[model samples]
Target: MDTTPLRVAIIGGGVSGLSLAYYLQKQGGEAARPIEVNIFERKATLGGNAETVWVDLGNRRHPGKPDSPYRRWADLGVNDVNLATYHRLRTILGEIGELERMKPLENTESYFSRDGSIALTDDRELFRGVSDPAHDLSQVDGGKLAVLMAVVHRSAIELVESRRITPRYTVDDFFDACVATPAEMLAAAAEELGVTIDWQDPALPARLERLRHTIYYPRISAMYFADDRGPGGMPLQAPFEYYRIQEGGSPPDRRYFEHGSQHWLEALAAHVTDPSTPGPRVEILRGIEVEASLSPQGVTLTERAPGEDRWEADLLIMATHAEDALPLLTFGDGLSDTHRELQHILGKVRYTRSFSVCHTAAARLPPNRNLWRTYNIEVRNPEDTFFPYRIDYVANRHQNDAENPAYNQAGLPQYFVSLVDDLNRIPRREMLERRPSPLDGPSALAAAAPGEAGYRDRLPPLDSDLEAKAWTLFKHNVLDADCLEAQEEIARYNQTTARRRFEGRQDVCPLLFAGGWTRGAGLQEQCLEQSAQVVELLLGKAERRADPLRLVPTGSQARQRHPQARSFTSVPTGS
Candidate 1:
C-alpha cells in the first residue's frame, strides 16, 4: 500500500514561497516520498513584489528591425543580486543551471553636486590618504572621507566574524556588545587588524559630518523608514555573517541576471511545476487571495474561485509579509498559547513604504561625460540649502549589453534610469503618474527645499524624448529597535519550545515562515537562507517519520543560529 503524500501550502508567491516549493520538490524527488506543494499568490502575477514588464521602445527606434519594435524587458520590482554575500541565492541559481546568467555590475565614477560645482569621485583615489596622515588634504577629491568610513565599516564586520557572533536578536543587543557610535565602531577591530588611520585629524570631524549628510544619510533614508523624532527610527545593527567575506572585507561587486532579476522567480516557478519530474508536481495558483484558519490537524484556506475556494494542507507556510500574512489567518481557540504568542511576536515588525520610478530618457541621467554606466548622484547646493537623496542610473548597463550580439537585436532605446525615493520625501502616486519634468514638483529636492539643508537641480531638464515610464511602491521594515525586540521575543519563544520538545512533551507549531522580513537582517539573501532553513526543518522531520511540519534543525548548530526563527512553533498533534 502507498502512503498518502504530504501536503504543503505556501502563501505569497514571491522569492520566499517559491524557494520553499523548490526545496520541497527536491526532497520528494530524492526520497521517493510524494509531496504535494501549492503556492497561492494574491496578485495576478506570481512574484508578490518582484515582477518584470517589458517596455516597448516603439518602432521608431528599431530602424530596419521595426517589425520587432526593439522591445526591452524592465524590472518593475527587484533589482540586483549581491553575489559576494548571497550564498543561498548563488547555490539556487547553480542548481537551476543559471550560473552563467549572473552578470556583475560595472562600477562607474559617481558625482556629488555642491557649491555650484559638481565634484567627481574616482574609486582609485577614494583611499588615497587612508593610511598616510602626511598627505596633503587640499589635493583630495570628493570621496576622501568615504575611505575612512570604509575602514570603520570593515572593522565592524571583522568584529562580528572574529567572535563567531551573529546578532539577529536585537539592535540593542548589537549596540550593547559592539561599540556604540559610528566613529568608534571599528576601534577594537582596527587594533586587531593592524590598519593605520589618522583618527585624530583636526578636520576629521567636519569631513565625517559632511559624508554623513551628503552620502550616508540619504542611503540610510532610502534603506529605512522616516523617523520624524530623529534619524534613529532604525538603529544600525551588525551585518549578517553571510553578507561579508571570510576575511571580513567589503561586499563583492553586485551582480544581476542578464535577463533581469525576475528571471530567478520565473525559473523557480517553472521548475516546481514541471510535470516531467518524478515526485508530486507543484501547483501554483495566481490571482488568488486566501483566508486561512488554523486548527490542530492542518490549515483550511478559503478563496473566491469555484473549486479553488478551499484547500486543506498538513502544513501552511506564511511566506508573505507579516502585515499581509497575519490578517489572512484566523487564530482560532484551537491554536495553543505558543502559537498565539508567536503571532504577536511576528507582528511587531514595522514596515515602511518604498517607491521607485523607472524612465527612459537621456536627460534624466547626469550630463557628465566621465560618469560611469552605473553611478549615484547626490544633489546639494553651495549654501547647504537642500540635501536631496542620491539618484541611481541604469542606462550604461543596458547600453553596454547592446554590444553583445545576443542582446538588443531590435535596437532598443539607449537609456534607462531609476530613482529610489527617500522615505522622507517619496513622490506622490499622482506626481509619478504623469510625465516627470524638472525637479520642480514635490520630489526629493522640492521636499527638502523648505528645510534649507541644501539645494540643487539633480537632473537636467526633461525633454520630449521621455518616451516610457513606470513606478512601483512597497513596504519593508528597517532593522530598528522594534524589529530587534521582535527578533528577541521570537528567539526566546523558540528556545522555550525546543526545551519542551526535548522533554518529550507536546509543543511547536505545524507552520514554517520564510521571507526577507522573517529574519537574518532582512535582505534578499536572508530570504533565500530562511527558505533553505524551512526545507531543512521539514526534511529532518521526514527522516524521522515525525510530524509533517516539525521545526527540527538539520545540523547541530542549525537551530542555535536562529533559535527564535520558527514562526510556526505550535503543533496541535503533540501532547
Candidate 2:
C-alpha cells in the first residue's frame, strides 16, 4: 500500500483558501496516510475581503478617565453575516469556538436623494408629528410608493416561484414578464390588494421615475445585487435562482462579529497552525506568488520571488478569483486541452474595482441626522442612475458598547464605512495613512501622561481632523449571466475529471478549484461551502454519495440539509 502523504498546494489565502486548509487537515486524519498542505497568499494578510482595522478614538474618552481615547475594531470589507442563511459558515465558526463572538446588528436602512432630500426612510422618528396615514408612507408620492411596493412584492414572489420550477430562469425574464409590463402589474396589484391605482394619472410617470432613481434602483439593483450598471448591466441576464437563494426568503437576520470579521478569519488561521492539531501538517507561505504548470503526474508550483523556490504537489487547488487564477497557470513545459479550456473559462470571469473607506465622515450620511439609520444610501449624482454613488454603514450602531451612554455622548466620536466607486469623493489628506492591522490583535493605543515627555512618542499618530481614517480598494466579481455560466461550466468540468479518476482513467487532470465564485452568490457562505466540497472529493468520499455531480445547496437549503449536524469531527484526529 502507498504510505506517502497526499501533497496538496492551495494558492490564494482568502477565506476559501484558509477554510480549505482547515478542512483538509481535519478530514485527512481519517485517511490511511497523512496529508501535507501548503497555503500561498500573495498578500501579507490572510483574509482577502475580510479586513478589520482598529479605530483609535484619540483623546475622545469620557471625562476623568485615564484611558481617554480607546480603540474600536471596524470591518472595511465584509461586515455583516446573516445568521438565517449562513449555515456552513456558522458550523465552521462553532468548530473553531468563535461562534460565541457573533453579535446582532441593527440593520435599518435609509435612502437619500442628491439634493439632500430624504426620499425614503425606515426611521419612524423622522415622521413623528405627521398624521398616522402619512407617517406610514415614505417621503414620496403616495401613488409612486404604492406602485413600487406592489412591483417589488410581485417580482419577489414570481422570482421565488420561478426558481422552484425552472432552474435556468434569469432575472431578465423576470423583468420582461413581471416588471416591464406596468399596466399588468398595476391591474394585478389593484385586484389583489383591493386598492385603487390610477395608471393613467398625468404625474404617474415622473413620480415613478423619481422612485426608480432614488429608492428602487439604488436599493434593489445596486445595493443588493451590486450591479452598478443598473438595469442595462449584467445582473439582468444573471440566473435568478442565485439571487433567490441569497435574498429571496424572508428578510435576513443580520449580525456582525464583536471584534470585526477578521476575528474569525484569524481564528481559522490559528486553528490550522496550532501545534496540537493532529495529522495533515499545514504550512502557510506568505507574500509568495507562484506560477503553476500542470501534467499527468501532478502540479509544479514555481515561486516568483527572489529564491524562485519550487514544490511538487499531487493536486493543486486554486482558491482565488477566476481572473487572478488565469494568469498563474504557466505553460512552460506544455499544456493539456483541459488546461487551455480552464484558462479560457477563467479569462471570461469579470471584476470591477471599488473603494471601501473607514472614516468619521458624517457628511457622507444623510444630511438630516434624523433620517440616519444603520445603513445610509446616498445618491451623489442623481443623473448618473447606474448606481448609488456612496453607501455609508454606521459602525457605531452595531459594534462594541453601542448602546452604552458613555460611548454615545455628543462629539465623542463616530465611525462610518463608506463604499464608493470614486476615491476623489474623500479628502486627499486622508488618502492612505493607517495600515491594516496584521490580523494578530488590536494595535495598542498610546498610554502616556498628557504632559509627560514621552507622551508623543508613545502614541501612534492620530488624525486630529475627523474625516477619512483608512481606505482599501477591492476587486469585486461581477456575477452577470456569462460569469454564472462559466462557474457552472467549471463545476461540470471538475465533476467530469473526478468521475474519470473514480473509473481508473489515467488522463484526468489533478487540478481543482474552490471559491465563493464557484457556486451561488459569492459571499462567505459560498466560499466555505465550495471549499468543503473540494475536501470531500479529495478524501475519496465523493464515490459514496448517490449523485457525485450534485451541487451542494446554499442559504435556506443548506440550513435544512445540515440542521446543527457537525460536518467535520470535533476531536483532534492525527498529529
- lDDT winner: 2
**Reference-based lDDT, each prediction:** 0.52, 0.62
Error of 2 at 196 (Å): 11
TM-score of each: 0.71, 0.78
Over 1-575, each residue of candidate 2 has an lDDT whose tens digit, in order, gives 57997899999888999989988887889865678999997755667777666656556544576654455667767787876778888888888898888876665667776575555565432321222233234434643575566554544444343223222333444444433445553454445556566666666556555545555556554443355565334443243344444444366656788777866886788789787887588888876789988776788999988899999988889898787786787543444688678876776576766767777767777776656667777654746655633577877765533444555553446777787777668665443334334344522212211111111222355444422346666566666555666776777666776667567676777788987667655678778777877787777665444333223333554333222223222422111
Q: Candidate 2 regions off by >4 Å?
A: 123-154, 157-161, 164-173, 179-212, 236-251, 332-334, 380-382, 385-389, 400-406, 409-411, 430-469, 543-575
